[model samples]
Target: MKINIVNPDLNELGYVIAIANIKDKHDTSAPSDYHWKILKCRMIIFSNSSILACPDKNDVKQVHIIFNKAGDDYDKLISLFVKFSLIQNGGIRSATPEIYQKCFHYTMTARIAPVWNTLQDNYLINNRDFLVTRGPQEAVKYCIVVNDTFTVIEVNAVKINLMLTEEEFLPGEWIRVLPSLNKAIVEDSYKDFSQGSKFKSYKNLRRHWKNIHGYRLPENESAYYSIQFWRGEPLLYPKQCVLRNFPIVIPTSQPLEKLIISRFVTCLTSKMANVLGTKLIFKLEDIQPEDSKSLAPKDCLLETQAVSLCTPTQYSRSQK
Candidate 1:
């Protein structure tokens, strides 16, 4: 969705102001999936003189904003510098000159508008722990249950994949695990086989299966049925709910290749989406940080020191 604000009253605000036309497509279809609809908006204000636009990013608050936007080019440049310094130094602690300079560099080279206000910060903090579904299947990876000992038990094959490996094998992530069930099983066994092996007896294997291995069919519980809206009607279907109560997963019949690419891209903007607390979209304009204030730190000296000295040096040391 795109919103165009044409010829906003510059006399009153002296700048063109326009609202992005936001459409809640989900509401039109799946009304319950999302509570609000958001869209990307762009405000282009061209004054007789060069309009200075400065953006500030605060780390403590994790918010970005544009401070002042009406000045000469030189002043605008300075304002941009200051805006960057503010964002890089908005935190409670002071930053190093080097850190402030780095922030300035980022601002000077910025291609997109910074988010305004502390809303971005809140969104980041809150959605940091969100369950994002990105595979072609969009199926729930597993069900999580905590034992009395506080140990978590994941209850699905996909969950096993995620926990056992760093490579993200989301529910729908496609891999050629033999198409035929029997063929797949034989391939899996061969893939796991090593050059030398012991315990070849069927009884020994059965003992291993009984004592060290677990075998069971997927659960067919009705509660596992996920409800989705089609047009104006509700449809009950199978879905994967993460171990956590939040972030329900629904599988798609699409091919695996397409799903994987789309999901990876979605992860990149997750930071922006969570920061803005708006639905995720490719449009960076929709992500507003909630006003102009540097959330990083005010003082550059301390910020640099913290990064160079205060923070853990394990990575640097390891490199050495």
Candidate 2:
């Protein structure tokens, strides 16, 4: 039950920027569950510079990006000539990215793996897609300018229009807002007997569960009866917003081990706090993208239910 971002001014520091309508933590009303009923209104902005894109001031929307961070790094090996495209989303409980093309300021990226020498199924499922390789353009590091105002984010089916990060490309990721300990899931040493195999429950998950630091996420509904809010449709915004950072480009190099043993880094809010080196603090004061319904807290709004993911009786809280 944590969510912080106090005294931020220096562009906004590192970055994660939020604006959720959050609520799809599962329960797809059951037809087979893949209909995704309501969790739209999103406005994410993870950073490492490449700043907000898609708002062609006069024309300059070029694509091809790939300097990846956050989530899966898997111990290095996908620098295939290095690109730098740009991008968004709703929720996903499971595969739904069929996207072939739709247009409106486009940018495509590709580099999935798992080909263990292709002995067919001998090395167990390994035939990932998207591998359109290319090289040279001088390997552009990062750059973006044109910020007068821009942010529309419709999320669900898709609705773009970004251009709000004035300038950034520093050494990002050592943000501090503190207050966060209380994560008990434990159990890690990585094992997997692989019998009926649902990954044998994947060794109980523990690539990073942080567990402590300052504090701030309460905002009504009694803080969800005292910790434990998670289902997955992207929650955690609780209140007091006001950020504007966009510095990024962390790569001193060190993280590697990750062949997929349930690293589960982010279901939107298990960002597992206690950070400093990895860089990705979250916030966005003045609430852009039309202020995102005031970021809720009309006293939790229950009877009428106008703000969820936490006040509608809790539904997400796993930043660790």
Candidate 3:
């Protein structure tokens, strides 16, 4: 959404004064829920002036403002920086000396990947031990690694705040074996094959199943369900697993990929819709920091003049 303010009144120094409303979209019926959570607000000023007068004079042209949204109010009138002097043939520039910090603030709704099921349970066990012992040790570091092009990056272990509902996995889907499954049977039967080995790879194992167990392996390995058993724990045979109320966690850290960020934004927008009990309709705008010295300043008079139109009437009368 774009808002334009035209022909704003200038102050005594002949600078435009404007107020911008910093708000998120919401439904009138459910005032409690907000569609878009404004993590940060960036004010970009485009003018002919080379040097602008801003709230902070140290850096003149643009400013990044942070807002507090804990309150119930939605309408926030923020005074932005616009005062400045025009430098002939000057272009737009960022007044701040430091680079704008790239940060994000939004909520998301994502399915707990089947792999995360065991991880979450393990985390709870470790967390509970730490709490009981009151140890100074850091919590176990768990991350999700994704292959980006050729590079592999790990995502930090996320904590789930709310579980909206339980979603059942349909039959004939690939699922990871729970750690609590029988380890002895798995190790004794499939000692030759490594963890996560395909059922078709070991032809002898397949023959044993066909002869002893009286079951034949699926002709197409790709179509058959696959499972990732716990480390050092092999599955005796393929078994179907289903998920229930898989926890959804908040993404607290920035991801390496832009596509991941976009997904999070979409998920969060949908979650907000569900919370508000309203139709899901929203947009996300990435708040990227601007570079300094990008644009030149425009032409404007200096405020150094001693005589002004609004000088005190008493002083003027006494001097006369």
Top-scoring candidate (lDDT): 3
Q: For residues 192-259, what per-residue lDDT tens digits would candidate 1 score against the true structure?
A: 21212233432332232222111111233212211212123222211221121111122223354234
Better of 1 and 3 by TM-score: 3
For model 2, where is the 10-residue window of minimal lDDT? 205-214
Clash count of each predicted structure: 39, 26, 19
Per-residue CA lDDT of model 3 for 160-214, tens digit only, reads 3222223333344333222222112222222234444533354644443332212
lDDT of 1: 0.21
CA error at residue 319 for candidate 3, angstroms: 96
RMSD of every prediction: 24.4, 23.0, 28.6
Local distance difference test values of all predictions, in order: 0.21, 0.18, 0.23
Give me the runs in candidate 2 sitting further than 4 Å from their true place: 6-266, 271-277, 281-293, 296-320
| Total colliding residue pairs, candidate 1 | 39
Per-prediction TM-score, please?
0.16, 0.16, 0.18
Best by TM-score: 3
User: Candidate 2, residue 271: CA error in Å?
Assistant: 6.0
Give the winner by lDDT: 2 or 3.
3
